[model samples]
Target: MRCLYCAHAMGLATCPLGTVVPILNRPENADILDLLNIPKDYEVAINMALGYPTESPEPPIRYSDKIKIVL
Candidate 1:
């Protein structure tokens, strides 16, 4: 379905060397839909906040302590 594609796109945006974010806000999607004047048939699938990140992103935290590296 189209929703799945939207989710996949969002996931890809957050993947390594990518830029995209989808965060939940205090207001509900209905509120946004009303403001954006999106047709009732449509819905706000993903709400994103765009801006220059204040600080450099840190690498994902890993569990190197328990897992053994087999190189």
Candidate 2:
């Protein structure tokens, strides 16, 4: 998870390891690769979105009321 340069950069300044999104929806979208000029030998296994949060997220729903717990 730690590449030499990545570790170095992170050490120098906190690199917000942003949200990791998958290319599941558009796996076959070669436009991204073309845009980036990525060679055919390589492939995009994962994707990421980096930015500051716009607002606080909604609270998670509690399953306690919905699903019966069986111990």
Candidate 3:
């Protein structure tokens, strides 16, 4: 999960591609794992896919006033 989060953050910082998390039980999961030569002893927890965006989206507005800071 931590690795997935770091990869997501890095992707967001470095590229325009969007990230997708595929279901673990999908039929292609095994094939993908095999193709990647991942060890059989390890289980797939999360699968992420990165791809180019087809359209531009408006940036979401942030409400900083709603956030509270505590020390």
Candidate 4:
């Protein structure tokens, strides 16, 4: 994640307003719209329907040929 709003990374956590604000989850209507004051130009990288995973996904099998360095 980019440290744009993180005070610890920027060394401003002690400042008055630099203390971070929490964005609360909003319901699915006009209330959510007001909560998220996203600009027109902004875009969401990921949007998820949050829930516990019923099954654990296995890691992909790695191929040995891909490990060689050409240089």
Whose lDDT is greatest here?
A: 3
List model 1 lDDT by residue over 9-44, tens digit each.
555222221132122222444565667677767644
Q: Provide the lDDT at 3 for model 4.
A: 39
C-alpha TM-scores of all predictions:
0.37, 0.34, 0.37, 0.28
Task: List candidate 4 segments past 4 Å from native.
Answer: 1-37, 67-71
Model 2 — TM-score against the truth? 0.34
lDDT of 4 by residue, 1-71 (tens): 23333543554322232122222222233354355775434433433233334554564556756775443
Q: Cα RMSD (Å) per model?
A: 8.8, 9.6, 6.4, 13.2
- TM-score: which is higher, 1 or 2? 1
Q: Give the range where candidate 2 is weakest over 10 consecutive residues by summed lDDT.
A: 12-21
Residues 1-71 of candidate 3: C-alpha lDDT, one tens digit per residue: 46555755665322422233345435567776678787767666555555444555765556758965553
TM accuracy, model 4: 0.28
Give residue 2's lDDT in candidate 2 (0 to 100): 45
The whole-model C-alpha lDDT of candidate 2 against the native structure comes to: 0.51
* lDDT (CA) per prediction: 0.47, 0.51, 0.54, 0.40
The candidate that achieves the highest TM-score relative to the unseen native structure? 3
Provide the lDDT at 63 for model 4.
Answer: 77
Candidate 3 deviant stretches above 4 angstroms: 1-32, 62-71
Give the Cα error of residue 2 in candidate 3, in Å.
Answer: 8.5
Backbone clashes for every candidate come to 0, 0, 0, 0
Model 3 residue 24 distance off true place after TM-score fit, in angstroms? 3.4
